[model samples]
Target: MQTIHINRAEEMYDHPPIALAVGFFDGIHLGHLTVISKMIEVAEVNKLKKAVMTFDPHPSVVLNPEKKRTDYLTPLNEKRRIFEKLGVDYLFIVPFTSKFAAMSEKDFIRDYLTDNHVKEVIAGFDFTYGKYGKGNMLKLAEDRDGFNVTTVSKKALNDEKVSTTEIRRMLMDGEVEEANAQLGRPYKISGLVVQGEKRGRTIGFPTANVMPDEDYVMPKLGVYAVTLKQLSTGETFKGVCNIGYKPTFHDPSKSAVSIEVHIFDFHDSIYGERVEVFWHEFLRPEQKFSGIDALIAQINQDKVKAEQILRDMEL
Candidate 1:
């Protein structure tokens, strides 16, 4: 997919009319798929180019000054990967700057959609845009001089709405399985293996210290059944990951949370290697063990549970 930064758009982008799915698409969860599927259908039927329009930095980053936290389930690069896999022809990313947020709904439609030859736009029922999100799906269809709009109704499971907020809550509560259910896939994150205190090797369980590549929403402090993939080699391994402060060795309040993954039956120096970690299941909360021996024993148990979970998942 060709990633286009709308804020830096030029007239050279002239092309055939496109059917665009518009949203921030933070997680690209099942709810988002509902809309994108419709967009794909429309684009194919009308012989229009397939495209997705999203925003960067998230609106909350610019609109809500007091909301300091900026975590994303799917960062821009990851989002682009998904779009390309979905066969989207174009991926439009609009910058969510203070100046851009102040624009009116009409100006946004004319400047971004119409100017880019967006003939059909698809979005969820709750999608809104323009200054302070004053534009709703209903309003978006009105004054449509050059485009038509389709609104996909709320997607839900078990009578509960499938939303990013709920998914984030599940991850924060260490309910990765449940979050994956909402996302229609396992929750994955990308990071680079960095050098650490090298304590795991002493305990007979060597680990790769992972430092995240983007501002991702971290799950609860605990152990998880995961699969780690080395980007360059494309080799994936089943593992048990501990995202904690190593409370058994240091003060939890003082140490920052670290990502330590023990690749089953493997040993190699992978520092500086880029990898992806797919969270499959939550094993247990991080706790302060009494001693090194106690920690090692618990880790052994964690490995047993993690291996079983990964074997069952087979992903």
Candidate 2:
């Protein structure tokens, strides 16, 4: 998708009239696909450009600073990648600021709709906007004239609604397989491999430590079967990852959580290199062992299990 950062409504007029889908679309899961698919259908029928309207620094982060910042499932870059893959023609990343937050429902429609020649607008059934999220789909449809407004109902899985929040909950619980099913892809985090303490090397399992970008959401603290992709080489390798402090080495209070992975039969200093790790299966929870001997034993066992799982995978 052609990504455009929008600071004002007037800028939108430069583009051709379009049919738009609007949402934060944190994970771009199946539910989001439902809305995006409908938007594409509307654009095709109306002979208009297909576009998506999304916000950065999610409004919640700006409107309520007191609340803890939640990590995004699909960060801006990844979201744009997904949009491109979905065949969206345009993506407007509106900067979420106090002024934008204060806009009224009518002003938003007037500025983004009337001025930009938006042929049709699409959003999820629970979509809200305007100051303090006071605008609802019903209100927008009632206020707008001469524009088609479509609201897609929530998509469900096994009777439960499929949502970004639900998928996040699954990830936080280390249910990687279930989360991947909901996402329609493996749960991935992209980051740079940085230098670590080299403790894993001493244990006979050298690791590449990845420090994810600030906006990337991390999975739960545990061991997982993962696939590592080197961006520069476009090479993928089976791996095992640990997302937690080295509890068996240092005091729990003094240690910090780290993401370290050991790619099978792979050896190279990947420090300062960017990589994408796709979490495929949850192997076990993080635990503190009695000593290095016990931890090494567990690590070996985990590697065997992870290797078997990767071999059995269809990927």
Candidate 3:
């Protein structure tokens, strides 16, 4: 897919007319995919380019400046990868800033949607745009612009709406399996392995400590069944990941949380290597052990649980 970074819609005027699916598309969940699929269908039927228009920095970051940080389900690069896999022809990334947020509904429609050769605009039913979110599907449908608007109805799983917020909530609660069901894939986080004190090595379960990317939701403190994929080699390994503050080996100076994964049947010094961990199941919460022997025994139990879960998943 071709990515077009634009500060203004005029930048997209030269491209072919497009059937655009516009939204934040954070998780690219089933609901978001419905809109994109419609855009693709519309484009195929109308002979227009299949396109997606999303924003950067997230609208909440600009609209609610005091919020400090906004965690995303899929970062820009990940979104691009998913879009490409879904067969999108164009991906337009617009910078979300205070000025852009202040654009009037009429001006946004005229300058952004209409001027960019958007023959048909597709979005989720709840999607809103323009200053103060004054633009809605009803208003867009009522507009006399030459382009048409398509609003995909809410998509659900087990009677609950599939949404990025819900997925984030599940991850925060360590409900990986349910979140993956809604996401249509395992929830993944990528980061480079960093050096640690080699505490795991002493226990016969050497781990690669990962320093995760900022602004991505961290799962609840727990041991989880996961698949660790080394980005450089594309080699995947079954693993058990622990997300915690490591209370078992307390150090007052180490207050930050850590993500350490112990890959089964693997032994390598992978410090500084990039890897992506796909969370499959939540095994148990992080626990403080009485001593080194107890900690090792509990880790062995956690490994058994993780292995069973991984076996059930057939991954």
Best by TM-score: 1
Q: Which 10 successive residues of model 1 have the least lDDT summed?
A: 6-15
Q: What would the per-residue lDDT of candidate 1 be over residues 112-214, giving only the tens digit for each residue?
A: 8888899999999999888988999999988666899999999998788999999999999999989999999999999999999998998899999999988
Indicate whether candidate 1 or candidate 3 has the larger TM-score: 1
Candidate 3, TM-score vs. the true structure?
0.95
Tens-place lDDT digits, model 3, residues 66-175: 86347778888888888999999899999998999999988889988888888999999998888999989999899838799988999999999999989988998989
Q: If candidate 2 were superposed on the true structure by all CA atoms, what would the RMSD be?
A: 1.6
Where is model 2 poorest over a 10-residue stretch in terms of lDDT? 61-70
For every candidate in turn, the CA RMSD to the true structure comes to 1.5, 1.6, 1.7
TM-score of each: 0.96, 0.95, 0.95
Predicted candidate 2 versus true structure: per-residue lDDT over 1-315, tens digit per residue: 678888778877788889999999999998999999999999999899999999988877788888745688999998998899889999988988889999988888888777777889999999998887899999988987658899999798889889888898899998888888889899899999999999899889999999987577778899999999999999898999999987777676898788999999998888999999999999999999988889999999999999999996664
lDDT, candidate 3, at 188: 85
The prediction achieving the highest lDDT against the true structure is 1
| Candidate 1 TM-score, true structure as reference | 0.96
